[model samples]
Target chain A: MLLALDVMGGDNAPAETCRGALMACDRFPDLEVALVGTGSRVAPLIAEASSSVAKRLHVVNAEEVITMDELPSVAIRNKRKSSLRIAMEMVRSGEAQGCISAGNTGAIVAGGVLVVGRIPGIDRPGLGVPLPAIDRLRMLIDVGATVRSKPLNLVQFALMGGLYMRHVLNVADPKVALLANGEEEIKGDDVIAQARDVLRKGPFTFIGYVEGKDIPVGPADVVVCDGFTGNILLKVMEGLGEAVYALLREEMGQRILPKVGMVFMLPMLKELWTRFDYEQYGGTPLLGVRGAVIKAHGRSKAPAIASALGVARDFVLKRGVELISREITQGGM
Target chain B: MLLALDVMGGDNAPAETCRGALMACDRFPDLEVALVGTGSRVAPLIAEASSSVAKRLHVVNAEEVITMDELPSVAIRNKRKSSLRIAMEMVRSGEAQGCISAGNTGAIVAGGVLVVGRIPGIDRPGLGVPLPAIDRLRMLIDVGATVRSKPLNLVQFALMGGLYMRHVLNVADPKVALLANGEEEIKGDDVIAQARDVLRKGPFTFIGYVEGKDIPVGPADVVVCDGFTGNILLKVMEGLGEAVYALLREEMGQRILPKVGMVFMLPMLKELWTRFDYEQYGGTPLLGVRGAVIKAHGRSKAPAIASALGVARDFVLKRGVELISREITQGGM
Candidate 1:
């Protein structure tokens, strides 16, 4: 099956995109990637790939490029020939099963909604990222797919997230919960209060409100919230993770004992980091979109892009988007 | 100066409160702490202290106790002589300069607002917790004081937080930024977009919007957001910290070499943790209240309680309330 990759997206674009496409080919033999970008920059890199990898890779040259700082909607409206647009168009035209972009998330979400369209009964599509908990991976849904959302949107988040976790992550009877400041039924604002009522009776477990502490450790398999809360929580966790490792490194530099201890503990520390690393986990899927779409981080390297491609491939093969479509249509919002 | 302590609050109540009171007396010579709770439960703990330490201790009987799970507003209206009420009453009556509670945060906030009253010109009172960043502290305001806040309340949070950082945190000119999902100026929803405009026109240095990553490592000295966002960010960071350490310990158990490595690294790791430890920072101040009110964590031990008492004492001595009143009244909310 053919998948589209935004070759000119992310910080290290074109080169990394070419390398990642080759790596993704190594993982999934049935996968063929259509690299969407300027051919002059991408074709040379694709030429460097081994014949086996190169044969599966094809470039979809789109002259226009959307810079990272460019406004998403503006890019969508103006740069219709941009790589982001071309990649989504491939999905829209059924030329590719799904597409993965490491471009601006806002642009990708906008593109996914405006260009690729959303599922029949879905009001808003959401981005779901896997949060690595102690014993398991919990789905953190709507991580900036929609900034301002209604109660019904959150209910849809629970539906989509529950389906993804159950099918892809292979968790039986996944617990779906709304992310709130407090776990109490009466806590949170008017919107959340309204949401609690609907989510309680919705399709999925609907275990009720959960706090931030519950997100990382897992009292629930799928945690749903508005984009605002989800985005901040995601970044804060990322910042803390970076700070902890940076602090540990600084600590080892301070004294002799720690400096010596690091030599033996390096392997364990590496394992500890790998356990929490985001690159190993694939792209954040933009659920509710008409076709399968995955958004990798903006600063994602070759490995992460490749991982995202694999995620896109899995998303198509695993029928994640199709399940959401069926769930939304049959469930009847 | 006398500060009232809710001796029956938190996980390790009366005993830890008494010990913390004694510890505070040791730290600050002029400080006196009124242990407000059941005299029977608190008096013996005070008696356990050295006679010299006991000189500064006083007991005020509060027959009612508001358990952690007790509904905050219900507790406020029904349990009139509860420890939280008595202590806040002490602040209201001008008997105590301020009060510290390691009780239910919602109840403490309610008591602080309803009993102690809000300062003049204040729209809403917010909680300010020092997020221990890598090098210094970033004042994280509105840590669940008012979950559903207006844009204007966020404006007040910025003013109060900026002032607190400049005076207490000792930054000459503190940089205040609105906490958002993205660092871009137009990132957040309508409320935040409106808040950015107000903050830009306000008294302090308005450094546009900052993401969650900016909180744990500094770009802005104070980060302002609604209570919901702030609370989730705080708890998520805490959970991630705990998870990282727990994971490391588990990894160390997997091998003898790493186990030996852990022994040598213990002191350095301890020092590293101490640097980011919340117990060292003291209690979170409830800003915009008529009197100084601090809320210690519900699970606070003796050290955290002592730290909280010290914070209350500092709030009084440093005239933090007066400055906020002056700033708000003059600045015009």
Candidate 2:
């Protein structure tokens, strides 16, 4: 599978991106990678890798990089030679099976939708992020793309999320849930109520309405909602995680014995911390699209970028795009 | 100030409710308390209190109690003699300044709106809860009352939440923020964009759009949104708090030294725990109403009921209803 990487995308661009691509080459020997960025900027980092690994990496020169603050529509229109734009175009032209970018989310989302386009029957493509649970991770879709959605949109999200879990995470018949105010079928607004009705009658194993608290409990494999609510919930969890860690650190500093005990508990603490870390799980896939488009965080380091590349490669190998398109066309609400 | 309490409401009704009312009487000498519930259930608990304190409590007989499973609209219509309905009627009939209940939230909200009516010029009333932040408690409105709302409704929530923060929390020129997916003005859905436009030109110190992360950081005095997003955010925060506390308790039990350290840290831990405890905050006030109607948790204990009464008394004494009414009449939004 040929995967396009935006080498000049994230905060730690060129170096981390190049290093991550090299790492991916080592991990998956059969995978071909095209590093889409300025060749001069990425060559030094590529040189650090083994000669054989460097030989495996192909450089496609692109001059501009989209910044975090740039307007997404304008950036895509003006920066034709930008790495993020070019990478997405490669997938559109069939040069690459999938594309990965750790850059401006707006630009990435815009490029994925407007440039690469959505699947034939899909209403809107959604971004799915895996949330950490006690036993396993829960995939939350439409995290920040397509804010205003109809009941059919939510049903599509559930279908796509379930497919992603089945193919990628290897969870068959992933229990799908509609994020609502309560767990009752009669609860929630008109959108949720209608979605619940449609989902129950449509496809997949509908688990009825799941409350917001259930997201972390892992009762359901795929939780579906509009991008607005999903994005807000995702950020709230992230903020809460940061706040808890800060409070724990503060409490550990109040006494001498507790401080010593914290040192002893470092390994256990590290294990606990990894459960909430997003980088370990890699990039979020923009599902329900004609081709695979993965978005990594802007602050992602080498490990995160490498994980993103692996995710893109796996999506291509698993034929995620084709499966989702087929599912939507055959049984979509 | 006179406060009416539903003694037979909540999970620990009559017992904890009776004790909490007596505790409130002891704490504030000028406060008058009226316990409304079935005489058979509450008489014994009231008799358990000190004779002098018990003498100050007035017992009003209510025939029925609303169960958690009963629909709020149906409960209000059928259970006319219930504690929740009677207590709210007391406030409506001018027999009490404010009503407090730890009964069914849907019933409380339904009765509060139907019986007490909305404040003049207000569109829809909302449930407002104070979230415990790092530096201070931030007020979030429309927690779960009205699910479907327009941009105008959000503007009203901002006005009501701002007034509540200023009068109740004593914050001057309360900074108001629209809870959105992103901080950018151009970001979010159509409703959020319209809310931003309205808020930018309306009264109160608008702080622009605030992300979900800012809710717990206490960046704004008032965070406004439709009930759907607000309710989800509230429940997610509660779930995270419970999850963190549970993890901490388990960690404290892992070793002897850590257990010993936990003993010393118990007081501080308790203090931190209290900050996130919703029971301490008593009830969510139904803002944009003619008279104050407080809705406590359906699973509330007696202490929570008593605290709700205290909140009611404070709202009445401060003339919060009239102040907000006048503010709206004077074009607060």
Candidate 3:
């Protein structure tokens, strides 16, 4: 029931992380949070929160803060007292069932692998990120877990992703597909070609190839690819989303009629923005690990951190990580 | 200069192709086109045009048409008299300086290799596509030209992409960067890691690594990567653009004030759409080829085809293709 949180991670650390923990505590009655950060930094935020929210939260002091650009290997070796390390340690020692960090991605990936460790039979871990599409959130797996991937790894990714979607998200019979350049079977490189054959034999609903456009269109609930491709897709979608918003703002000039028109469209625009909101999706889970380790966005606010905690709770409750391990071991290709 | 046109290719076929050719001629006085397709199918479209516009257009007798889903190797071997083949043949025989097609991409790549051939020392060709960022166009080289690429191929891509940007797009000393998962020097796969080393020694201005987010932000004028990565980026961007538009439309409903606001924003929205318009980008040029061969979008209308013709003309006039051959051979990385 207890979750360790890296409060000193992300752009607006301690403050947002503490507030988000408070929000998650308020949202979930059974949840307890171990807020790992500097005591002095988190005390004021903890004081400001309501008594009911504060009762469910506890502070685990760790003074050192790892900057956004710090090397993951260096942090893993040198910064033993860092919030990310401390939070991860909590999960390792069984003090917390899961942990979340809104910090450096590289550090989180490294910390998850080195500290939390992979499940017994899993070859490699994959980050299953929920990318918000027009109608629903499409899970793009292996979004920079490990750059190098074998065909067998992609098949494992499909299994892990399907388990998460089916158990956590409650999507029954998740339709999985390989993320290829073209929809046709013969339209990919050697890795994809080999993965296609392996995926067909897996337990998930293996649909044919889905192109890049299909990611935003929601052709399949779970789209599996190598870490490199998945990372690029995830980041490009992020950048394009920003570019689109920038374009709309630039084009929405301060004309009299248009200015008045904006008032009417503000609610609708808000609604549209919320549809693709990352805050609701929370952090990404590095599935195939022994315990839940969520990588919240680098610039995560109170809402995003709260959503991530909710996801972490769901991950543990639904036994998603355990399910992946069992599935991969039993569904031997 | 004379150019070969594939009137039977694309969704709209001879009508859009003929109109696009006429528009290109009207825009550029010195241009002449040998429209290659069935004479029976193209006659009415040509006759329907004004006398002045039709004067520069000549229909070459190519009755065969290649379907979109046909296998590339099959299209190459079996459909010899297809419009795609006839246009490539025009480039090979010196009948025309260049050719343009809105047909099967795989087929175009195959014919370009089989008929037009590689430019002597060039090992493989790359498709240099102009993707419009908010600020300007960034040339994403090797957009599905060759899926599997070596370190040397990436070096060639940088040189070829740099030449196209400098000469054709008029961006002198374009900053070149390898597309990686992260911006850090060591943060990439083995192929990218080795390519990074090769790029530093190459002729162009080699700026280290650029992430997918950097593509829309316009950090580097030319972003080089293998075709698989490049194709995913290109297609994903296209799909995301569509998704955003769909989101806006769906959200715009529900309120009466938002409905009236749409009228005021329509012009600005139209202007914004034109900025990222694929038609404006024309088509991607198969850059390491012997002659200019631009691959227009398959669903291209008159405007896109017209833009592609303009691109083909620029490719020839600027000697982009020949320059790539010379640069790659002489650079000898």
* Top model number, DockQ: 1
User: Candidate 3 DockQ score?
Assistant: 0.71
List the lowest-lDDT window of 10 residues for candidate 3 chain A.
A251-260
List the global CA lDDT of all models. Answer: 0.86, 0.83, 0.86
RMSD of each: 1.4, 1.9, 1.5
Give the least accurate 10-residue stretch of model 2 chain A, judged by summed lDDT: A257-266
lDDT of 3 by residue, A1-333 (tens): 999999998998888999999999999999999999999888888897777888888999997877878888788768999988999989988889999999888888888888888887788889999888888877999999878789878888888999899999999889999888788877888888898888887688899798888988966999998888888878888887788777677666645655666777777888777888899997899988889999999889999999999999999999887788778678764
Q: What tier of docking accuracy does candidate 3 attain?
A: medium
Docking class of 2: medium
Any runs in candidate 1 off by more than 4 Å, and if so which?
Answer: none
**TM-score-based ranking, best first?**
1, 3, 2
**Global fold similarity of model 3 (TM-score):** 0.97
